[model samples]
Target: MKLYISLLLAAICCNWALAQSDPLTVATFNIRYDNPNDDPHTWDNRKDVVANLILFHEFDIFGIQEGLSHQVNDLDVRLPDHDFVGVGRDDGAEEGEYTAIFYNRTKFKVQESDTFWLAPETDHPNKGWDAALPRICTWAKITSVNAGQTFYVFNTHFDHRGVEARNQSARLILEKIEEINTESLPVILTGDFNVGQETEAYQLLRTAPGMKDTFDAAEIVYANNGTTNSFDITTSTERIIDHIFVSEKINVQKYGILTDTYHSRFPSDHFPVMAVVNW
Candidate 1:
């Protein structure tokens, strides 16, 4: 009986080990709206600086919130090696803000892409919510170039105001996950949730079956207590608002919040969060 128990335990340990060896890296950044408040230190003026920091990270996939069409285009031009997809937050007009995703073209091929609005009556593609102008969540199906594996990546920015919108947005995202991700492929949901670790949206996402927060999983390995901070234009106090959540099927390797204050005078109000994972 003791020998049988030992054999079973060893087998479980080996399986767990295998599960943790898959390789991938992802990042989420909430680039605050282009405001003059950050003048002389704005993203517009420091595109090279922002692109340099992003390229230095060498992320396989990157999701950006509060991106405007021109900004996205600028990133595409700067990071010519990456492929991106995202529509404007206000219909197909490309006038309002956006939540965009960029993937290294050499690392992954974009299979599909789409955007959804977050309002209660969000039938259209991009419509403003009650509190903020308009919010969007972008989804992308990407095929890994090396492993040839496919996965679903979803990114969104919740309404800063309207508690109902945030809660409902959580539910809506979960429902969409179930509806779209039927293949059981690995998934990474990244974005600025706009709520803390204690909020209902956070609870729902963290507790969801088959889903796990990368921060919780990698905390044991990395000593990064601060994962994000988009507010506070002056001092940039460290507060975690951005997140990178992955399915249980995915293995989290390392995670950290990028706080490179030198290069980023004011690239965005929020710092970007990154994670390395395997599946």
Candidate 2:
């Protein structure tokens, strides 16, 4: 009887441990455009700083926005253990800007990956938006290594000043997400939306079928008050421009905006928003 009781206790402990370890962490960051305004002041200039910051977060999946080909290549070199999927935002071929998804090679398998331009002219890889420049969204179907569960991940960077572009982009993303949801797979969308929760774009995204902001799903989530002014560090004003939105099928364990204090060195102007979820 004693041996049987001990075995039962061990089995219970193992089950609890498995439940606790099933959560996956994901992040969305708009690594500021590599440009002159950034202090270590240069595009792709502070590669080490950016790489280190991302490594410190230890996210299982990352959705990065506004990265050029060189910048993405640099990160790939820096993070040898991760695999990335993305194409130039301008064309399906790898030649322009990108919204990329980086997943830990050991943690997830990329089943399918593709990019879509945020405009009515979907035939063209990147054209039709009234914004100053074109915008793109990258998506991937990923399978978790530990649980063997699969889900969809999407990332994008909306136009900064074009109101119509932002609204239309939201609509486009929603349509794509709905198409993918037919399989009933959980979905995660992350990026620099360039709009606040009160804006129409934000409202459109939240109301989309089966989607919910991770931060809103968990009432205890930390506010991203410092993330908006991430580029202009000199100012104290806050904006919640970056976000991680998850489909209702997934459970949001916790979510937070990674602040400057968490890093030994700052990587980009925008702080990364991370979410822990049970898939």
Candidate 3:
């Protein structure tokens, strides 16, 4: 009986060690753009709130959608411990909204980074495929400072008004991932996809080979509702458009849709989706 107990204890220890090894906390937040019409919930009112949430959660790396250049600057000032990479979608040079990736500078080292428009002319900025507005994706090849592990992170905000644009953008991203990741490193994709899970565009990404939704793959989950709240606590939380997908090589230990609010108001219209993963 003592031997049996010892073997059980060893097994538990092994499993715990494996789960904790090189764990990374990643999140995707669609912080509503700094729109003045969203009064009472404008960026000025919620900038610190958003920064506080990121700090409190201790996110190692996170992607933000719908943040303008000034908003990014605000976060940069607030989160001095971290650094971000990405450019505005309008001109690729800080003119429009940014799909930015923020990382803890001391925890990870960026090996390479760039942004590309989600269009046939990926090399330059242009509206693509019946899109209402131009859209872009920002990606980075990052290495973990502590573990010396490298992976790719791609972040984007899909065009909300264009159905065809969303579909084409999804395909374009898949192709780009294949092209850019020559090392075949593990990939982490996060974004405000702007479409529900039932949509074809979402399904295309969800069914992509070597990719898995972290939410579905996690061993522990804390999602009680959908991601978008639209600043109204009474809003229906049935549609989850924001997402995070990872290469199959990574193991997602836990996933959550953080619905944290400040003084009964949301920091953003969309709730941030967070995952704890390890390779």
Best by TM-score: 3
Please say which candidate is ahead in TM-score: 1 or 2: 2
TM-score of 1: 0.86
Alpha-carbon deviation at 233 in model 3, angstroms: 1.4
* Per-residue lDDT of model 3, residues 183-216, tens digit only: 9999999999999999999998989999999978
Judging by TM-score, tell me the better candidate of 2 and 3. Answer: 3
Cα lDDT tens digits, model 2, 1-279, are: 999999999999997678556978899977766777665535555677778778887888999888888889888999988989998876676777789999999988999988888889754675546676788888999997776788899999888878989999999899988876579788999999999888999989987878999888864587646565554445654568788898887788788887663234456767889888884
Q: What TM-score does prediction 3 earn?
A: 0.93
- RMSDs, each prediction? 5.3, 3.3, 4.3
Q: Count the clashes in each prediction.
A: 3, 0, 0
Listed in order, each prediction's TM-score against the native is 0.86, 0.88, 0.93
lDDT of each: 0.79, 0.81, 0.94
User: lDDT (0-100) at residue 68 of candidate 1?
Assistant: 80
Q: Pairs clashing in candidate 2?
A: none
Candidate 3 Cα misplacement greater than 4 A, ranges: 1-20
Candidate 2 wrong stretches, greater than 4 Å: 1-21, 37-39, 261-265
What tens-digit string does per-residue lDDT give for candidate 1 at 163-257?
77788788888888888888988889999998888899888999998999998887434434454444444554445778899999787878887
Question: Quick one: best lDDT, which candidate?
Answer: 3
